[model samples]
Target: MPQTLKTLGPKAAADLDGDLMSDAGGFSIDQLMELAGLSVSQAVYNVHPPSAGNNGGDGLVAARHLYFYGYTPVVYYPKPTKKPIYDGLVKQLNNLHIRFDNETPFDKLAGESDLIVDALFGFSFQPPVREPFDQAIAVMEKGVKPVLAVDTPSSWHVEDGPQNEGLGSKYMPDYLISLTAAKPNVGHFKGKKHFIGGRFLGEDVAKKYNLNIPEYKGLDQIVEVPVDVKVEKL
Candidate 1:
């Protein structure tokens, strides 16, 4: 039997996004990036076991350096400018004084860090990545360490899943922070990819159509325009 992709229910989507966006003192991109950093950091722990001693932590053996890959210049290219995660993301890294680099050669990024945060692509990418980005993606696929894709990794025909009418599958993320309410059936047609089952969205927004980082209340609010709902006059 073919492996199946799980559906994200409304409550589940809200729960995921809410957990990230909701803060007592309103929302900010810095907060979101901080949450994301922590999330990726934890994911690091999940993949690599804690060190034998030194209080059972990874014990600094795993490199602290984290690299971000993406087209920062045009985070919202072809789309209207809006609040983006890129700014807060880099700022958060700087605040933490984390050794982070951006838009480097994919191989260099792959080799330099123990973990890679794949922010190279977002939901905005409708057409396939051509040329340099494609080459870069190919390199990313070769890294030995675990990859934490911000949105989803770039892949072929991922958007053209069997269930385009059902749920659309962009690129698959090893782990996904859905940003806002998880789109129902959004990733149902992931071909042969294996995604760990925990995707979250921002709770503040009702939907998450654009990548703009809006004030949220957890991952439990509407963040974007809901894609065309399958009409069912019941």
Candidate 2:
């Protein structure tokens, strides 16, 4: 039998700001990010190990650096910009020995990659995605391989799914790895697999926010969250 899954509404999910302070585990946002990245990489390895190549955005790029650990080679397609954030990410990728193609067309990269990690945007991103990201999403939608989204699918509203109409249904991902707690958009996730990572919240913090997150068994850092499960208030 499938395990019972718990769901949280946007109102309750938004209160998960517990990471702002050190919890019982004494994990800070930086530490949580490191663990989250490792968990995401493990999820990818368990489900779909990189074959032809792994393609992704900033979040996936960060995770891939941790995932491959300066060993495996992956591809990244960044928007044409000199933003300091992108510069920092590039520097990290260089240190990790990850390869990226900022000039090649999006469609070409999609065709070559075996898996696509939708890290272009997170739950915070609002629709009518701008510029190169819009184009990048289009190419990802056209590809045949499965896509694993970080947080929420790019181009998707945190409270609403791809109801934007402009992006269309093709923008949905096959798998999702939500950070911290599942966001409101997760309620509409139609993917085959949904996993939650970044589980560093203390019991007191979780209760204060009414996060009601399930416990991670044993030493696992990530837990599967089944879709279409019963909804419960936090």
Candidate 3:
């Protein structure tokens, strides 16, 4: 049988996420987020343990780990969340001198970089996008640069894919790093590659929610889920 992974809608995803971060879950939010970021970095490097390593912004975490993996990443964090987690992630990037071109135009960014990791809007983003981010998504839709989204593409709904049957619906990343488990919207993910990563989901969590996630081989933090496999509700 082909390898299978369960797909969760946003509500289920949110609930499961809460459980993973709860005292009963025995996971610190930062710790789990670190694993998530590491998993994403590993996926980007396309290697397992003993090979390459391990986000806050999710993008921030990915950027830091990618730097450790020997990739020169230039970031575009126009508006940053003021949370301590984000600050800490930024500090790590600053120590490494990872470029954060908040002033550079999106089209220019598209041309200058090899890959655009779209962490502009994470899983919680609602459609009819606000300020600069709206412009960012627009540029990605039209640009030629390859994109690797951290979770859902900027304006896409967690369960329904794109909010508008407009540009967002048309835009797809070159790669998508599905955190923890694949979200239902991934069925609409028209990216060139899809990867599932994250190491904090316990057997209890999965069993309670009936999440049929993949088993990470050995010490690997990520697993390549062949995009051809059909996605179904859990």
Candidate 4:
């Protein structure tokens, strides 16, 4: 039921996600992020087991699950968040002994990794790519390995595509895992696979938005959108 699924714009997507994390939706931020990250990890498992590296909680959440699912995930978080939740996530990974590589160059990680999880930014991001991420995305933009963007790719417009100047001519992601629902920018993704995740939506939010999320089969946390080959027309 591809036609049943709805796509939200940046603001709508952000609002919906906010609702899902708030008490109104009956979910804690960490709980939702954990599910979001799990959804991301499940998507990556289909193509590259044990992956989904990001500095965001989603990335940290993903790396933890990937580790349990049997992938030795290495994190390349250049800009770590100071928030308690994010810090706790990093701590959990550290306790798990997951490797954090702020020292290694992006090119080196890109060359060595089987799949790069583009969790540098998410739906909440608004920017022209700041500091270290700006430099990292530059290297990632030219990489040969496949990439699996968590929600929004770094520096990409939440509602649009990579209209950011430096991002326009760059290489696109190989796979994209859309959290909560697909964003409008999925229409511009030239990736091989597009998935809808963040499966923790409550009826209040979904009904409020009239979202028609496809059912995740069995116990699966994520489902393929069948838009593989290219999501540009989504």
The best candidate in terms of TM-score? 3
Lowest summed-lDDT stretch of 10 residues in model 2? 1-10
What global local distance difference test value does model 2 have? 0.65
Enumerate residue pairs that collide in model 3.
37-55, 38-54, 55-61
Error of 3 at 170 (Å): 1.1
Q: lDDT per residue, candidate 1, 1-234, as tens digits? A: 112223334455434455445674255545544554444434444443334111111101112222231111111112222556544444544564444333555566556444444555444454445655664456545544455444334442323322232122223334333333223334532322222322233333323332234333364222222222231110
**Clashing residue pairs, candidate 2?**
none
- Which scores better on lDDT, 1 or 3? 3
Model 1 regions more than 4 Å off: 1-37, 49-92, 95-97, 100-104, 130-132, 156-234
What lDDT does candidate 2 reach at residue 63? Answer: 55
Comparing 1 and 4 on TM-score, the stronger one: 4
* Residue-level lDDT tens digits of model 3 in 1-234: 245557877788888888887889877778877887788777767633223211112288878888877777777788888999889989989999988887777777777666677777767767877787876788778757667788678888887887557657678777888888888888887666788888777788888887765767898887777776788777
Q: lDDT of model 4 at residue 1?
A: 60
Model 3 error, position 125 (Å): 1.5
What's model 3's TM-score?
A: 0.89
The TM-score of candidate 2 is 0.80
Cα lDDT, model 4, residue 71: 79
TM-scores of all models?
A: 0.44, 0.80, 0.89, 0.89
lDDT tens per residue, model 4, 102-138: 8877777777677788888877777677778866678
TM-score between model 4 and native: 0.89
